[model samples]
Target chain A: MTRHMSESDSDRSPDAAGRSWHDMGGLPAGGINPAEHDFALWEKRVDALQVLCATKGLYTVDGLRRALEEMGPQAFESMTYYERWISAVTKNLLETGVFTTEELNARMEAVAARGATYGDASIEGASPEGET
Target chain B: MTSLPHVDPPAFPPPYPSAAPRFAPGDAVRVATGHAPGHIRTPWYLRGRVGRVERICGDFANPEELAFHRSGLPPRALYRVRFTMKEIWGERAERGEDTLDAEIFEHWLEAAEG
Candidate 1:
């Protein structure tokens, strides 16, 4: 995709070289994609995980934001909102040694292989209190 | 609040009484230019930019400190700083009418030297 930057855009901010990923103030925002404010199923799951983890005292909102901000420029630019959230949450979990990279990869592989049966048996027990 | 021994306190309170806010509404100020690690709410675009304090939104726990799980002691006064898009984006601003309002904490601001 072509960036809508002007010829003098770079000269405007001499210090842009050191600016962080979250600094997108004057950059080419292209048109706002006017999609309705709708969350995909997986996006909803990501949001639920964030809220649940925070409620359980695992991490603070600020902590999660900091993790997202620390993401590499490419990943930060490429990810969707919920994708960034999940990536940051997972990074936090891994950094704190709550789980290892290997374990996460293995679980992903297992879920992919098992597909429909991955969490079927545990769904009843895993249902949050009072939800059923 | 009951919490696991390893878990940090979730609530952040001022570690000490904050000093009186230095500036008031309509006061001219400039965002300080500095970079530190961890969670910083100050947007880089506003750094070193001059703006007027629209209003004092009162004090709250310093989010920068809270990002590291520390008590945001002596909550910094939060201000709604108003700036024209031209001020932030210089000649690159698309429209002269476009404006931006950012919530900036006192620690990130200083009396406008200009």
Candidate 2:
């Protein structure tokens, strides 16, 4: 597997002094590059899969793979049970001086509430299926 | 020396001995036993890792038995295992915070050092 540089490494480039920016493909230096960010995203999704598998009693390998595939990376990051992964990802962002924990938590809470509303609506819509 | 009355060898104990003491929440364990072929719940990546027990999930009824296959075996117990992020991902994990959890079968557990 090809190893990518960490966020810190991306910020500083040995090739350029004073220039401060280096481009390897489309990704730039300074903030979390797309590749590193993507890895973090994938890791968070996997962590969420682990949490879901554990909580739902879906421990089997096949169950985990299916859950991961279904949850997708974005959905996994937003899941309430996988909040720890969200916190960790947010903490990483915070250490980079990107966002405060309180702010991130608030944003997550809002997103979760919206998701719950949507889920409830979907359940209500499906209620008529078996009602004879 | 003449042998006394010949006695049959003590019947070999059951091939897969029942899990010693069902796993419970808060137990520290490592995966130590299993031998089923094909896809399994416990991946090889997590085989020897140690983690804290988060919950004692109930017995696991074999999925195969429900689909018209043989049906004499009892369900296996399940446990939720929590591992530190560092243990699973090493330096890849962020510093300070450390933990992740996975559901595992009781057969996967062995005593882990504190």
Best by DockQ: 1
RMSD for each of the candidates: 11.1, 19.9
lDDT of 2 by residue, B4-113 (tens): 11112223432343454365456667765343433345644354556777766556655333222234158776666777644443345574145566777766688776
Instruction: Identify the runs in model 1 with alpha carbons over 4 angstroms from their true place.
Output: A1-15, A36-40, A76-79, A95-113, A116-132, B1-19, B90-99
Residue-level lDDT tens digits of model 2 in A1-132: 011224323322344232211112223435754553223343555576556644553233333333333344465446644454434334334544456778877987887887655433333355675667
TM-score of each: 0.69, 0.36
Each candidate structure's count of clashing pairs: 1, 5
lDDT of 2 at A110: 83
Query: iRMSD (Å) of candidate 2?
Result: 21.7
lDDT tens string, model 1, A15-127? Answer: 66556667666565678777788666567788999899778767678878888777867775688888889998887777667789999999898778977654444433565
Per-residue CA lDDT of candidate 1, range B1-114, in tens?
100011122244334443587876667788887766567788776776777777677788888876665668878888777776666665556873466778899989998733
Q: How far off is residue A26 in model 2, in Å?
A: 25
Off by over 4 Å in 2: A1-132, B1-21, B33-36, B63-68
- i-RMS for every candidate (Å) is 13.2, 21.7
